[model samples]
Target: MQIQVKDISKIYGTGENRVVALNSAAMTIHEGDFISIMGPSGSGKSTLLHIISGLDAPTSGQVLYGDTDIHKGNDKELSAFRRQKMGFIFQQFNLLPVLSARENILMPLLLDKRQPDETYLREMTGFLGIDTRLTHLPHELSGGQQQRVAIARALIAKPAIIFATSQRAILTAKAAAKW
Candidate 1:
């Protein structure tokens, strides 16, 4: 899938309290592309990702995935689109505390009513170096280990695109190389 991010902007609040998070930002992302948005803190990197990925709406303009304007879709349609076509690795590890690493990794598949492919699951976890920690809960893992689990979870379904914020922040160079 190719992504086109047109002249999108995100504004918060109004009057004196208003903050412009994004302004006329535009870009194009094609399949198999590894693009990174870089800026100092509070420069709308996350905001751009949210708008482009349909997690949040832009104050003006649009984000399109091929011919479909993703932001124009209703909540349910957008949710399904995100689930089936995109993967996300949030800056904060969003692992469920009650679930084991394995369960967290399998959550997306379960949500889609699809069964896990054991071979792919095993290889993915192994590649991310979380295979031995699968049965453990998030709290039982180290910060890096938690990040690895999150990364594995994002990639388990092999979606067409992945949106990640600071995805390598917690990982070492060696660990990131495995990604």
Candidate 2:
């Protein structure tokens, strides 16, 4: 799916403390494109990603996935859209504490009640170099290791798009280039 962003603006607060996080930002995400939005702190990189992915709504303007406006639907529709078509790799490792690395990576398949193709799962895990860490818990892994687990989880679903921070992007790209 191609994502088109038009005049996207994200504003925070009002009255005395208003801030414009993003202003008239525009971009196109082509199918199979590996995009990286880079910036320092408070640069609205996350905000842009959120708006484009329909995870966060822009205060004004439009985000379209193909020909459909991403913010057109209600929350329920949006949630389902994300569940079915999107995968996210957050800067914070949002792994379930109680779940093992394998379980965390498979959470999306579980939530959608789809049995993961075992052969593909094995390939992905090995490709990302997390095959040996599957049995460990998130707490048992280092920060980089946990991040790889999150990457594995995101990639396991084979979604149309995956969003990640810059630091996480490098890690994921390196792991993916392994095979």
Candidate 3:
């Protein structure tokens, strides 16, 4: 499996205010596999994604990417792992209001001190049907268009796993299937 999570558990707070975010949760995802996690509020979907992406550590159990234990890695290592191997899509289209679509899409590559891959960037913009809107700011676009820009940004890195929240499920499903 490309991703394996075992006996994972997460608890928030303690004593009377304790909340179990995840309870002995386990799952496996193979390469090129597509899956959906559907549930009502407070069902641990976000927490599971966070743990798998190495954004948050579980209170107990382990998250493995291939044979490596992600939780065992230090913060800098985990940050690099996440930057190079994972893509996250939140419900809120998290785009910088001041930047144009192209700039926003290129932000990750810029941050990693790498030049933008023009061909890939173009392909991503084309795939998301936002090529013409590349020069536009976030506030200038409609909700769906803004979401498409965010999707392009996420795909620009070509990560192994794309973790998406519920609101972006439709776009995420489409992008995952396309890739």
Candidate 4:
């Protein structure tokens, strides 16, 4: 899907303590585009990602996925929309401590009540080299291994847009994210 950001700005705080996180920032993410965002600390990179992914709203302007304004919806609406359309990889793995790796990786599918294509699951698990680690919980895996599980979780649903904040996860995502 093509993503368009128009006249976007994100401001935080107010009065003397006001901060402008983003200002008139705009970019187009074409379908199948592989792009990297680079900036120093507090440069609005994360803010932009959050806004574009509908996790956070911009202070002003529009973020369009095709013709639909993602920020146009209510919390529940946007939440469902995001679940159906986007994926995310956090800097900190957000796996559930109570769930095993296989369960965590398949959470989205379970939540959406979608059938897991056994063939695709096998391919993805093999691709991530986590086929044998499925029964282990998050704490049982190494950092890199845990990160791989998170990546697989993000990929299992085949979301159209993926927003990632980790370098290692991003590298793996770039390799596996094929349209």
Tens-digit lDDT track of model 2 for 1-179: 78889999999999999999999999888998987777776899878887877878999999888888979999888876776678888778899999999999988888778898889889988888889999999999999889989988888878888887656657878999998
Which scores better on lDDT, 2 or 4?
Answer: 4
* Count of backbone clashes, every candidate in sequence: 0, 0, 0, 0
Ranking by TM-score: 4, 3, 1, 2
All candidates' lDDT scores?
0.89, 0.86, 0.86, 0.88
Off by over 4 Å in 4: 167-179
Ranking by lDDT: 1, 4, 3, 2
The candidate that wins on TM-score is 4
Among residues 3 or more apart in sequence or in different chains, the pairs in candidate 3 whose N, CA or C atoms overlap within 3 Å are none
Query: Model 1, 11-94: lDDT tens per residue?
Result: 999999999999899998988788988877689988888888887899999888989999887999998888878888877899
TM-scores of the candidates in the order shown: 0.86, 0.83, 0.86, 0.89
Query: Which wins on TM-score, candidate 3 or candidate 4?
Result: 4
